[model samples]
Target chain A: MAVYTDITESELGAFLRDYNIGELLSYKGIAEGTENSNFILHTTGGTFILTLYEKRVDRDDLPFFLGLMDHLAQRDVSCPLPVKRADGEIIGELAGRPAAIITFLEGMWPRRPTTAHCREVGVALAKLHLAGQDFPLQRRNDLSLPGWQRLWDGCRERCDEVEHGLEAEVSDDFAALEAGWPADLPSGVIHADLFPDNVFFLGERLSGLIDFYFACNDFYAYDVATCLNAWCFERDHSFNITKGAALLAGYQSLRPLDAAEVEALPLLCRGSALRFMLTRLYDWLHGPDGAMVQKRDPLEYVRKMRFHRQIISATEYGLQQS
Target chain B: MAVYTDITESELGAFLRDYNIGELLSYKGIAEGTENSNFILHTTGGTFILTLYEKRVDRDDLPFFLGLMDHLAQRDVSCPLPVKRADGEIIGELAGRPAAIITFLEGMWPRRPTTAHCREVGVALAKLHLAGQDFPLQRRNDLSLPGWQRLWDGCRERCDEVEHGLEAEVSDDFAALEAGWPADLPSGVIHADLFPDNVFFLGERLSGLIDFYFACNDFYAYDVATCLNAWCFERDHSFNITKGAALLAGYQSLRPLDAAEVEALPLLCRGSALRFMLTRLYDWLHGPDGAMVQKRDPLEYVRKMRFHRQIISATEYGLQQS
Candidate 1:
């Protein structure tokens, strides 16, 4: 649904002259990414994805996003590699927007993620974290605590419109999280939004991870928390512990969690839930009328927030003590 | 922008089992056709397009549309051929909708079509018409005179919401067109919606035609009239006679227009314009609020209708007098 900028044949022909990829056979505007225009470019060489960064993405963060993919792919983390131009720059300009072409990954993201899918996602995410440790670039996770607070403030007055008691419940949750939020967890580059839609799999085996736009340097445990919120919840907003156990066990097999990290897991889950809920709430209140981007209901995250609040230990999430 | 039906990985895997196509490698929802939900399916065998017919298209007409493409491809017309299932059935049920797979056609549609592109389209369209002459199944062109009148009746009251005096102008247009409507012309299967978006080009060569959903039994000259409305005008709504001449000459090279057909060209063009304008106006007035499908301005077609109304001869459309 994200074909905001239309690329003409002559313009695309001129643009491809800068790259060594073979003659352009065809290109299609794909309904893949949300915040940018994406086209599936076919050439005599191979198929690739062309993304034009829209205004929602910060221009300065292009290097960090594209470079992270480069670093991860180099480390054998299955992900797209940003194709460099003859000038050696990964980013180029097309249709008045910053653009880049990346190698097309071959897999479909599971629509209904199973327990096996959760386990594979956990392994892929940990591998990404380990691979990203040695990367030179850094980008602050802007959707962190302060950012959540700003988003909450923007939508607090109108949040009740989405759900009658949403505003007060979120306000109280914020106060609780602020008082007990973890200050010292292991930090690294994290795919801050590791939703099922962003992870691809060929059958049961995880093929690759995508949508690195939300990726940034943050507590790796926070990234894990986001995955827990995304993958372990059923349609009824009920936590599926078997899926949770599978996800956590798969991650711990790669990078074992410390005692301190285990204790902080429940609170981090609440924080992650808050981050998504606040953003969704802000969009629910302030998004332009009739936007093509379907609005994710903030109340879904609200239910997740409420579930996490009742949790007393990581054990409740089916995390086994090592 | 038309991914209305969400197909699960499991659903797709089960669906592909009925076909001879190899293992499913990947599938992505594509933004190609406006009405039906389309997904580009990549399998071990090859790439293909999976289309789920939405409510906008009638289910009964599915055979005619699929059969036409199959027939055209058999006769060497460059278009996507519908892939049949094991039971020799071309259509099947998926996600509560009728679905079919077709071989993916390679090439991009011209965004800013030139005179060369227009000529190529003319040649390819004529080739399609010739190939489809032997097509067995016949589906009536629902969006012809009666269809236009029905659409006009539905939107006439609120048509002024789009323009101040559109109702009166359109009424006069209807009176004139109905009186002069051709009772007979070179009749055959016609691609009623052969817009530039439906035609693909690889460089200057016309690669293929697509979106057979609007194909039906009609006057061949009426199809040409749709193309003239589609390709021979600049963005400013001014007719480009050079492009028009190239298109007509290219088409005539294959299927020469008879005297009666040539004489009815201007009226056919006017009818074509009114057909599109009425549909656009109806959609504009009655479309569900916040629809993802972009509503095209009826005013553009209104201008075209006005242009065709003044033309006294087919020469104005660049048709050569033999």
Candidate 2:
């Protein structure tokens, strides 16, 4: 649940004057994104999402996030395009927070994703990577190895509160991930946080991708690795190889992976798992003690990373050998 | 922040099958109402609000809530009429909670209301009261005097945590409220909680009323009293007489206040003020320590109640003596 900032009618009316979109009919604070205050804006023109970027998101990266969406939507990729203001600015300010209005996309994210949904996500993600090739803005993956280490250090003393031996086990996992991190593998603009919640579908067909707040320049295969962790896991923490095969097969249908990219898949998967685990653990220990936001169980990611640790080859994740 | 219940795609799809509303296009969990999970459901037909009643709301009282909206809408009052299922049932079970789909009302609630907005609210609220006159179903205002004392008892020991001498002050206020509480003065179906957030407006016109979860049989003047505390106060705690005058005058345009009701206005305002102050104080002291929902500041209402205590007559609140 979100909407930390409240936008007033007069302020919103003043803000809308800079846009070509018709009169503001209504807008609602949405319980969607965590790092931003999101409102579903309705106007005589049509519906759009008005996002007021919160403090957690860096203001400097606004152009990259908005520009990437605009770039992707222009191509065959299905994504929201940032509505440009009268002065041709994609970003604006509202209630002391940087904001942007993005064209609304019609779809609901698959909550209990089937194999078909996984395949559709693979196809959409690949299309996004292809479309983002010429996006003209750059943002490094902030949740990469170095960032993970910083997060781990911040909560290292209290990390064991989650699991009895979580601290020591994660320390070893950190060392391995750092040593075997992918140096190079088909790098492009990757939706670094391409979780199922960010991918929306109209039934079984992919409609759009959203929450580009975490989109950045990284290994495209690393994006695939994130999805492998997010989409392939069953409720019992068991990996579903059939879904994995469907995802990879769908990805290959659009953009084929090279030899080295496939080989680095398992390590990238470990890195992705570790990345989410460390952040969740840090939040579990240090997040605000209140009833306004629900905390995700860090131990769930601990179970996931543990599962990824046992895998030796990309073939275990249903990727075909070249 | 709201939307506590998570509805799976298959579950929602199955639920929507019972309605002729058309294919589900998109739905986003809204962080609006506190007691229920509200999802903005967009289908091929149009936009609607899907509310899954949380435990805080009584399931048995749902017919009254749903039926009141249906009845009020038929009488030309703007509200979210409950969309019935194929079997003409307004209520259904979804995600283990009692849920219903209501037609979406367009407009935004005024954050910083002006005198014009207050006048518009007065006009619409009277209309709702008039339309609800024949509403057959009856539900008591459980949060009235008795409920206030029960809440006060739960937090009496820790009442001083909010302010020194608070316990004694509130005890006296309670005694006075009980004695002065209106015995009978033109009571009808009242939107027991018609705070600015529950009322919507497009431009200056009051588009509709929402969050009827608190609607019940109570003094119509008491409902006005709730608004007096909710709408007429400035941020610094001083009452705005201009806004109050507009609200009173606009409301009297349709439903003239009886002499008895007018005489009882001050005590009813105090009662309204105390009712909110008690619940908010209880939440402030005993609300969940971890993340899930927000607890409003109780001291603000305490200040408003104090203001009402000093007032001699309704004339002080911009109401002309009848």
Best by TM-score: 1
The model with the greatest DockQ is 1
Which lDDT value does model 2 have at B305? 85
Task: Give Cα-based local distance difference scores for all models.
Answer: 0.90, 0.89
TM-score of each: 0.99, 0.97
DockQ of 1: 0.84
Candidate 2 lDDT over B14-45, as tens digits, reads 99999989999999998788789999999998
Q: What is the interface RMSD of each candidate, in Å?
A: 1.0, 1.5
Per-residue lDDT of candidate 1, residues A1-322 (tens digit): 6777788988988888899999998888887777898898889989999998898999999999999999999999999999999999999998889999999999989888999999998898889999999999989989988999899879988887888988888889989988998888899999999998899998899999999999999888899999999999999889999999999999999998888889999999999999988888777788833366778898899899989999999999989988
Task: Mark the 10 consecutive residues where model 2 chain B has the least summed lDDT.
Answer: B287-296
Model 2 interface Cα RMSD in Å: 1.5
Task: State in Å the error of residue B157, model 2.
Answer: 2.0
Query: Comparing chain B with the reference, what is the TM-score for each candidate?
Result: 0.98, 0.98
